[model samples]
Target: MVIVLSAGKLILTPTELLCRLSSGATLRALPDDIRLVTTPPLLIADAGAVSWTLPLDGVECLDDITEFYGFAKE
Candidate 1:
């Protein structure tokens, strides 16, 4: 999935979202009324208004780097 973390905003793909959950990221289920069986990150969808503050340390952001360097000059 393509996830862009530019300007402190999270633009994630459906597949990426699932990846985070599987990786054990924390999710905050705001608003009461939501029913969830597991508190693990994988079960975030079950919780209503799922929220998480994930660190994009290893995650790559294409916007931060150039895809092709010195291609035009070559």
Candidate 2:
């Protein structure tokens, strides 16, 4: 999935710690309702809606820098 960020770019993975953070999406503690079992590529809409094609089965938390791609971080 690919989410369009405010920076006018696309966030390919919603579960990526870096992508989520860079996109300005707050990452709170894991909620009982939500479980991060797997870190799959996610696509979020500019409106903040999240969607993923793969199953999230074993994901825990996102890191500060998940993976650097495309543009360099300032």
Candidate 3:
């Protein structure tokens, strides 16, 4: 889990991600459910059948998330 007071929570499991990003929305996804791509300041993720751009702080924190989910890091 990555939790920052200025940001929010990002919980990663072998098969899932429970994320409440800095955008103030609670979200969830499973591995392979959709692609998760991290830009410098945003996480492009999927919610249900739709996709959302979730704001995330700190590149290091974002890196942890992508790595855990088996996505290639930049």
> lDDT of each structure?
0.28, 0.30, 0.65
TM-score of each: 0.22, 0.19, 0.64
Give the true-structure RMSD of model 2: 12.3
lDDT of 1 by residue, 1-74 (tens): 23433223332332223223444442333223122222221112234344433334331332221121111110
TM-score of 1: 0.22
lDDT of 2 by residue, 2-74 (tens): 4334433334343332234444554422121132222362322222354332222222211211232222122
Ranking by lDDT: 3, 2, 1
Give the CA lDDT, 0 to 100, for residue 46 in model 1: 35
Candidate 1 regions exceeding 4 Å error are 2-16, 21-48, 62-74
Clashes of each: 0, 11, 0
Residue 63, candidate 2: how far off, in angstroms? 13
Report how far residue 37 has shifted in candidate 1, in Å: 30
